[model samples]
Target chain A: MKTNGIELEKEILDQLPAIVLAVDKNFNTLYANNAALTFMGSTPENVIGKHCYNMVRNPQCKTPECCIAQAMADGKVHSIRSEADGGTGNRFLESTAVPLKDEKGEIVGGLEFVLDITQKVLDEKKLNEQGRTIRDMSTPTIKLWDGILVLPVVGVIDTNRAQHMMDSMLNKILSSNSRAIIMDIQGVAAVDTAVANHLIKITKATKLMGCECLISGISPGVAKTLTQLGINLGSIKTKATLSDALEEAFSMINLRVITTEAKQ
Target chain B: MEADSFRLLNGVKAMMDSGDEYSVSGSVTNRCYIACINGELSSAQMGQLYDEIVRMAEKRELRGVIMDLNGLAVLDSAAFCVLRKISGALALMGLKSAWMGIKPAIASSLVDFGADVDDLCICQNIEDGVRLMSFQK
Candidate 1:
């Protein structure tokens, strides 16, 4: 039973997620747990008896804005968000210093807890980039086709996305000197009134640029939405499927005969 | 000197002198002054300055903050973000904030980088900015 209790205590200490360090009032390192050693990239032998600031190479210790010094002076808990270079690169860490008290409630030392939040910060940045990429893809703009632009737009067009789509498409049409453009929306779920107006604007922009924009892959539901939106598609060239759009685009640029001959 | 106490000034104008990237002038309603930074504003310096500004705002209701960047050749994104946050915090304290003396090239670069300056009141010169904030009084 005694051995089991000791093993349980060891297990709990090892399983703790935070790096824990105990330091003297002067900020000298007294003890460090396994997690702390791992975090600092050092062993207990090298860190023991050294000033914590010296070990971490903290330049602010000599300055007036030292949080550790303030905590020691007031006997209060202090927390700071700081960056540490852990041999790999700079990493963000949340460090908390709590004053240690003895039986008589006298301040003896302090315990420092360090938590690495580098992964969390990186994840948030990546998520933001992904959101921007997705928004750029959904918007009807020619910017997506800078290097042979291809848009496989699937789903309904609302007022907001439609406006974005028009802007993107017009910008691309003016910038790129491509002979033909293809917009495939075979899986589109629906279209609204504002969406129809945006479509008209896109067609007008393409005509002004002297480049042909082909719409293809329309579903039955999309066709119904188009009618309800009161959009006149009489002047716009469209195809039943993406394959049809490609064929039409090639023909418009006088590349159909050459491509057919090559295939044959 | 008391660690937290600071003199208040109404306006601050800084210009670079003799290899120094920053200089300060005018009354500081807040403890801190507008340092017309010509070069880099390192993270450490920014953190220290921000801490001082926060303390000053808490002690005395800081009325205005203006950062004149007439001589600044480069303004990094980190510095821009810090300024944005500081401006937002000052606004909460009913203090007016403006960034003046920005060169046309730097302004264009900021826009190209997609830095949101829409919330910030910007001026081409310090005098114009002071005039804009005069209504705050």
Candidate 2:
């Protein structure tokens, strides 16, 4: 009955997809389950009694920081992420090392369980790239008319986003030689001191480039907050509506809009 | 000790050399002078150019002067200050001065460094500069 129990355990371990391996304190392979044998592309005869580092190469295999070595020394489990080579190809793997002990409770070797995590790593990389694309798309400078441009600001304004906004505005002004730009803040969440300062800095920078910057879409709540904070936007043109701001911009550039009657 | 210090200062003066990193040349048209400037210039070079412009203005019956900077790529703080001074000096002499073709990057950089450019009359091109001068006259 005991022999049957041990065989059943071995069979269960062999069926597992995770690689199960055992190495002695000297770093020589002692045993490997079927999954490990297949993953390493080695037969039992060639794998047994061989240096595990030479058979399965990893970034930390030859270093003192090896998880297996750490587990053997501390008599505890240790985990690490490694870029490793397998029967298939290079793979990202998560390996956990558990200390193995003898009857005397003396640490003798380490048993390791390694899981393939290539797909997870690839997914995380893709998500990060998508995040960058979204960040760039969030802030856009659009040309509204000849010699006129408009930037519609939305959401929270952080330092990085503010710098990007300034860069985009400056580059667009240069490329188009725009004489005036209207900044609409109707979609902004709230106007705090820092946000107001960022807007002012952007205004001053545009002015330095000989382009006039007008602030529009100032809600009553934002105006009250600006006054309460005592933040002075000196000499900057502000309008209650985008249309009024556009009218001011037109005047600055010596332009005007006139209505004509439709012909019958 | 004082005599030795004086001799050392004199020797240092003798070793000093001067050079201009930029060139300035233009023409006088219809009582309006256009000074085409190119390349980066040191403070001394800018001062020399300012003096040359002022002398030329004194020599001719000019109503306006356009400092064409389309070819100038770099302007440090000192050079920029001198440029402003030149504009002010020309205004004092009753000649309308307009800065032409100020590149976008340089203009932004000047503001970033906290240089005062509030009163500068900036023009998009030579024709706009001429129109600005003519209008002022």
Candidate that would win on lDDT: 2
Tens-digit lDDT track for model 2 on A82-147?
887655787898999999999999999999999999999889989999977877787788998888
DockQ of each candidate relative to the true complex? 0.02, 0.28
Q: Rate the local accuracy (lDDT) of all candidates.
A: 0.65, 0.84
Q: List residue ranges in candidate 1 displaced over 4 A.
A: A1-17, A21-34, A37-83, A88-113, A116-151, A154-176, A191-210, A229-264, B1-137
The sequence of per-residue lDDT tens digits that candidate 1 reaches over residues A120-154 is 87898899999778878776444333323446676
The Cα error of candidate 1 at residue A203, in Å, is 4.4
Angstrom error of the Cα, residue A215, model 1: value is 2.3
iRMS values in order, in angstroms?
14.6, 2.2
lDDT of 2 at A24: 94
Q: What is the TM-score of chain A in candidate 1?
A: 0.45
